[model samples]
Target: MTTESLAEPTMRVRPGWTVAVVLANVGVFAAWFGPIQVLLAKQSEALAPDNKEFVFGLVTGIGAAVSVVAAPIWGAVSDRTTSRFGRRMPWTLGGALGAAAGLLVLSGAQGVALMLVGWCLVQLFGNAVLAAQTATVPDRVPVEQRGVVGGWVAVAQVPGALVGTALATVFGGIAVGYIACAIFVVLSVLPYVARAQDARLVVAPAFVLRDFLRGFWISPRRYPDFGWAWLTRFLFNVGNSIGLLYLFYYLQDEVGVPDAGTSVLVLTAIYSVCTLVTAIAFGAWSDRLGRRKIFVVASGLVMAVAAVVLAFWPTWPGAVLGAIVLGIGFGVYLSVDFALITEVLPNAVDRAKDLGVINIANSLPQVIAPVIAAPIVKHLGGYPVLYLLSAVITALAGVLVGKVRSVK
Candidate 1:
């Protein structure tokens, strides 16, 4: 199927909805990175400072495990939904509320068991919102606008991190910080759910148990482009998560920063600025030039190089430089990657389901990264080996993107 022959988008997603969705993404990041990060750190410090990596790994792994299952289920349901408020709205609202409830539980969590339950709830419901909201891109936006729309979503991450950090800092307590993030998440999602319109489907295929099960396995031989895209995203995200998710502990242990939390904000500030600038530029550039693979390959290579820098020089200065490079690479990848995915989907009628399968590549890595890194960080010295491993994984992602024949 050629890009030109694919159905034109039935509606153009408005700027208001786009902005609201972006803010919602920001809220998620704020919750995930800011308050959650601090909370976990405190827990790890209090419970097992010697095994900080292991504790953190376990927490993240639990959440990702839940997300892997929940995301696709929610996506498939959204596809078959025939509601008056539209397919995505109900799930969006439910996801936000569910996530908020989980956040409340996390705010008061006292033990590892409670922490595990709380984060699992967060991941399950948070992914519901993510799956539905992500579908909105291909659902409403025209092919021509996807790059810009993806860019806006991509650029929101940095600001969202900043907002999360500010909330955590201002609240000065994990419980209060979580409450603040929950409120922000609900508020961010409200405008889009309340005001933005989604088209009601007149009819959809009836859900079949066997068909639904089969949908999970899209043959790589039949849809090679989609297969390649999924592989590239999975590998790149795994590499990125290894470098990203352990930063709090990394700064505290490896760099010897007295206040790793504050230092993280500083480095993130640099990374965010670079991501915002580069995302907007590269997003627009991809739209104008009408190319995807080259940008993806370039981003992967850049990230690999950044990982190398961190591996060689394990210092604050090295981290800052690495953050800048990683930001550029990730920013560009985030902008164009979704646009590319939309173009390669095998069945337009099942776009949400297919994208759900693709989304696994994202959520799966959260599980895989911690599982892989925990052993490495625990047994094989420290982060240096991990960073070198990150470089190798990301460079492999670049090479795989070159295998894709569609979307370029």
Candidate 2:
């Protein structure tokens, strides 16, 4: 279990098809989230309207909420799907197509409701890719190799978020940003479908909805570390969500940076470049070291410290430094945390479904954080309080991660 011994397996862990799936998401995100609406005055006016911040928030929430249901259902569907391309591939392909359609719909959305509907669809079917893809780590990769692949998946986000954010900001147009995101999503995933071998029918059981729901409770109680792992994932993502979801707004409010096209591009470039490099390095290093929890703990602590710095300082320089810390911490966490989860499953038989439950940890916290954050920020006064609160949650999350002794 020592780092040196662990490192060999983790590093040698071929990403196989999972990395390809991650790439598809990158492309999809770039197209959907990227700036696609620069050309249309009407679209821009509504999206960035003088008085529709609430609407925008609502649209976003709707999108997030839609995924709650989508994720589980997609996981179930993949569980049921027994196809020639493999269960994961069919869903990955279908999810990509759904994502493409969703983006196309979003491109044409004319009103708040239409926008919400389009984004909801995108969030739902678009995220189906995750249900199929995440299970691949546990299903196919050796436990030791999981960390390296997780790193690959995590680093993929650099292009996924940064590239898309850049396109959206630079284009300053609605339709173009969206269409571009669709393209990115498709391109990123193609390699995964082509290269990854179908997982042999491993321990993952055939789907039975009734048993699956029961499996959630049965596994955690039976496997001590699985429960802790899920808790840690949820808490970690929650803390991370607070920092990432709000970073841009913090820049605008704290530094008084205008939300101009130029400013956004600069920020995305800086953030993406720093984060991508750190994320990939740390992910690989963690696998080599054969220690995932320490990195997870380190990620939480870094984020907490960055939150504190941002809370009190609120200057352009301070924000930049915070972003750097945040980037490194988050990148490492995203890259390696999945490895930790894969290590602790009760048994391999339920890998997909069990992993599905853990996947909820990633999604659910996203739902929980903004609801808690926006209210706290509103009541407590400003970005400082939000940062303070995020820091505390992050520290707590790090502690929860320590609860897992069995994973090692």
Candidate 3:
């Protein structure tokens, strides 16, 4: 396929294409989330037992900061690419390989500085893969089918995170765990890279420096739907990130789980199952109904309720319940919200760039979560207060999604 044919993707994407996209997402997320969910914390503890939280937060915050810059830049570059092999393919393959290299660096790191470098590399390249892959949805799939397809793509995160965590846990040693994750990252992405029928850009766009720089900023006043969509996503992720970032510590410090690592796996399992059930189902339902906003609003509110459950109850049973609720809410939000965002995009030519900008909502939370969460968790009523704050933010996200007038 060529870029000219995909001006407004009108045909249904084949099932094979959807499967490849889902698998690629699973790999990208597995590489990214594995460290976030497990290995990074262990490394931080190993390096600085007394101040592990600070180390973990700092490392992750800086890495996410790198992602904030890398995603949009890579997206813009790919937009202008004229590679015969296809604009997204080279980056998709290159990014996966680069991320694997980063994981290898992480595997060998004996100190915080090296750990920080490795993680930053992973985030930088991982976003390259993500930005390119996300653009493909709007490039190939019709608007009507996006909810169902988006649901399948969004749900990949559950398995990706679970598989990554499982690998980290099963490997036992820090170095070996990192190695295993790196291997999976490379293997899982290969199929998609090989099979993808990416739209090839025959002619590169002229690069006028001033215009190029200006293109990155989509005016919120002019593009209100995009702005509202971005804000709601940012708010939703802020709640989600704050809630999940310190879960390992939460289990260890508050719940007093026997094996914190294994407990995380168990909780994630429960979360994954619930997410699996609701993600595609709700997405398909929304596609049938031809509605997006209602599902998004309801999901955010449900997520808020889940956060409240965690705040009020800190027991094992409470954690399980929280995971189930959160999974259901997140599944719905992720699927429908993705389809909604694509519909509101300001330019067909800039799909990757716009989505990258939207992705800032996803990555920025990682940067902000640790900065805010660290202070709150340490001095401001600890986990309960932190979780209450999560509930409030997510509920606000639900309410604010109503402002997106373009998609309903």
Candidate 4:
């Protein structure tokens, strides 16, 4: 800890910085990941329909798999970096620019191979910022204030997703939609780069692959709550992604919208409004309650129950209602879980890196679930089975979260 940090806590500095980081994440989400959500859902319809779903899933999975593998190395690098601008800001700026370029590449993709390459780049470059971003909280904020910090980060997600959704209508279609998103990423990184306090900590590189590769072999048994946190994250993302992957489709197929363009706008609006309302409330509450595990477990169970309702009745109202309830649960989970992870984190010296590692559990399930869902839908039946699977898997994730005994 810095000597300045050791002085009696100042109300002015920390909260503002934390809020800036959260806003940056909001910007990244709106501009970077938001545009891609629609493409991920609808791309198969245009690009070799028979294989598009599976291919998209594979690309995302492979990229996410690569992320889990790579985040620690990037975190380690950031930990050691001593750039003029600050360790984290330099990484964030570079990653944001790289991600913007990746989006342009993805926008121009003509075939599956090119698209996959673009997607891979997005995961690698974009997360370079994300790793640094997540780590900054640990480096800059007092450990005790993590819940409030996490709340800020959680609140950022809704606007980001909503911004992307808004672009479709304003920009007119997928092509212009993605272009608008790129604008958001660029804008989001600039303030942090400009305002980010120059961190004085010195970081030095460790040059062995074993340093990064060894984490997988380390058992969470060593950290009792680690397994629970990881599994809950996995289950939550799986169920969430399955439902999300179909939002654009559901609006068209179920809502019977006349214009495809309009459907995109409608879904985005609904998603944004729902998310904004719930995430704000739940995120703030979790911080106040200081009971992360119970909130997470309850959220997961609620999610599973909502999934069951949707699975049985695949109508417009059912889907919308399910989306509302599911959104509430997800909002609660999303708002608090990361804060929860920060508290139960296994190692202090490696706090940011471990949180990044656990985050993989969240994304990996996303990659795995859709890869499995595509085939089941194309051949076995349709999204019903996928919904059921999502419910079962997510409920299992709740059970795992129940296993966590620390950090509550």
The residue-by-residue lDDT of candidate 4 on 378-404, one tens digit each, is: 776676777787788777776677677
Candidates' TM-scores? 0.95, 0.86, 0.98, 0.89
What would the C-alpha RMSD of candidate 2 be, to one decimal place? 5.0
Off by over 4 Å in 4: 1-15, 41-43, 203-206, 215-218, 254-256, 259-261
Least accurate 10 contiguous residues by lDDT in model 3: 1-10
List where candidate 1 sits over 4 angstroms from the true fold: 1-7, 10-12
Global Cα lDDT for candidate 3: 0.90
Q: What is the lDDT of residue 347 in candidate 2?
A: 58
Q: Per-residue CA lDDT of candidate 2, range 341-373, in tens? A: 778866544455566677677667656766766
Kindly list the per-residue Cα lDDT of model 3 for residues 1-408, writing each as its tens digit: 345624898889889888888888888898988889989999999999999999999999999999988888888988877787677888888898999999999999999999999999999989888998898888888999999998888778899999889988988988888888888878877888888777788777788999988988999999999999999999999999999999999999988898889889899989988888888799999999999999999998999999999999999999999999999998899889999999999988888889999999999999999999999999999999999999999999999999999888
Best by lDDT: 3
* lDDT of candidate 1 over 41-64, digit per residue (tens): 666666777777777788888788
The 0-to-1 C-alpha lDDT of every candidate, in the order given, reads 0.81, 0.67, 0.90, 0.68
Judge candidate 1 against the unseen true structure and give its global Cα lDDT, from 0 to 1: 0.81
Q: Candidates ranked by TM-score, best first?
A: 3, 1, 4, 2
The alpha-carbon lDDT assigned to residue 275 of candidate 3 equals 88
- Which of candidates 2 and 3 reaches a greater lDDT? 3
